[model samples]
Target: MNVFQSLVSSWQFWAVLSALAAALTAVFAKLGVKGVPPDVATFVRTIVILVFVSSLLFVSGQFSIVRSLSRRSVGFLVLSGLATGASWICYFRALDLGKAGQVASIDKMSVVLVAIIAFLFLNERLSMLATLGVLLISAGAILVAVAD
Candidate 1:
């Protein structure tokens, strides 16, 4: 098999693993938020991620991926990681402070933000249905946020 085919074949494996990871994160955030401040919970969660990634490097024998990193790659990775950490902190804090359905619905509207940013900056085109869907998502987020 060629390289592309080999990579494509393993997508399902990665998807399942990612789903499980997301579920566990939600569970831990909910449970951990009961007593700890959101910032502290986020700090602990980030520390856990650092340890998990370190373990994966050793287990997968891909620890050398870090060695070949260029200056730009390292900068981007650190920025992306920090952005995700902030997003998760806000996400868990929102969930802790509000109804799950409301929080989730609002968060789901980030797709619209992605589309808007792409359209403006990347000059991407959106179909009619996609435009309508974005409107619907905004309305839904408003309703969900104010519902409870």
Candidate 2:
């Protein structure tokens, strides 16, 4: 495959896109939440996401698979949705009160937290290098959060 095809098929490409989108989200949300209650901002964001994702699923012909999801999958997805909502509320509130960079740095600490949690509960193994990277990410987040 050519480089473009290889990148299109790679998880890293999607992850990089996700990171870029998240960075923009922090900036846009910080500006957008001005004068609006954080909760209301979050609600509006949720509605937009719902509409976007629903439309994407419909267009991709994937909406029908929702009915095929196992009960366990549905239950976990529900829990994940609740957790995501709570995180967004807290993140929006933080962004309202703090610098965007500071708020985003703290929010990105979830990367380290996820590594640890996955290791503990998901039977995931981290190589020494990966563990070091996680530690560095935690330290960098702390530095960024406190630098302001």
Candidate 3:
């Protein structure tokens, strides 16, 4: 299979890619927020993301699906967008005020919260091993946050 097809077929590949991108995001955002207000930085970043993603949607013909989306779907998507904007604003502020490593470690704790929320609200089930893994991740994040 082609490299594109191989990547599309592998969840591990996407996860690793996302991790690398997130690492770069922290580093780049730390630099970008220097001397700039976090809110402004977030706004600029959001504009860039909107342009890039809109371009992707147009190029991939996904824009056609927008007209068919239900109002509920659009509302949920708007809510998600607002949440993402809030997250970026807070993340930029944290990076501006603290070391990126510490801030990112604390941010990683969201994974633990997401798992718990999914289990409770979405009726998602976690096996014993998965629960242990989440606990370990939480501990590691805490250790990183508290470390000198």
- The C-alpha RMSD of each candidate to the native structure, in angstroms, is 3.7, 0.8, 1.4
Ranking by TM-score: 2, 3, 1
Error of 2 at 142 (Å): 0.7
- lDDT at residue 140 of model 2 (Cα atoms): 95
Candidate 1 weakest ten by summed lDDT: 19-28
Which lDDT values do the candidates have, in the order given? 0.81, 0.96, 0.94
Give candidate 1 regions above 4 Å deviation.
Answer: 1-24
- In model 2, what are the clashing residue pairs, if there are any? none
Report the lDDT tens digits of candidate 2 across residue range 65-124: 999999999999999999999999999999999999999999999999899899899989
lDDT: the better of candidates 1 and 2: 2
Best by TM-score: 2
Candidate with the greatest lDDT versus the true structure = 2
Estimate the overall C-alpha local distance difference test score of candidate 1: 0.81
lDDT sort, best first:
2, 3, 1
Query: Tens digits of per-residue lDDT for model 1 on 78-101?
Result: 998888878888987886887666
Residue 104 CA error for candidate 3 (Å)? 0.6
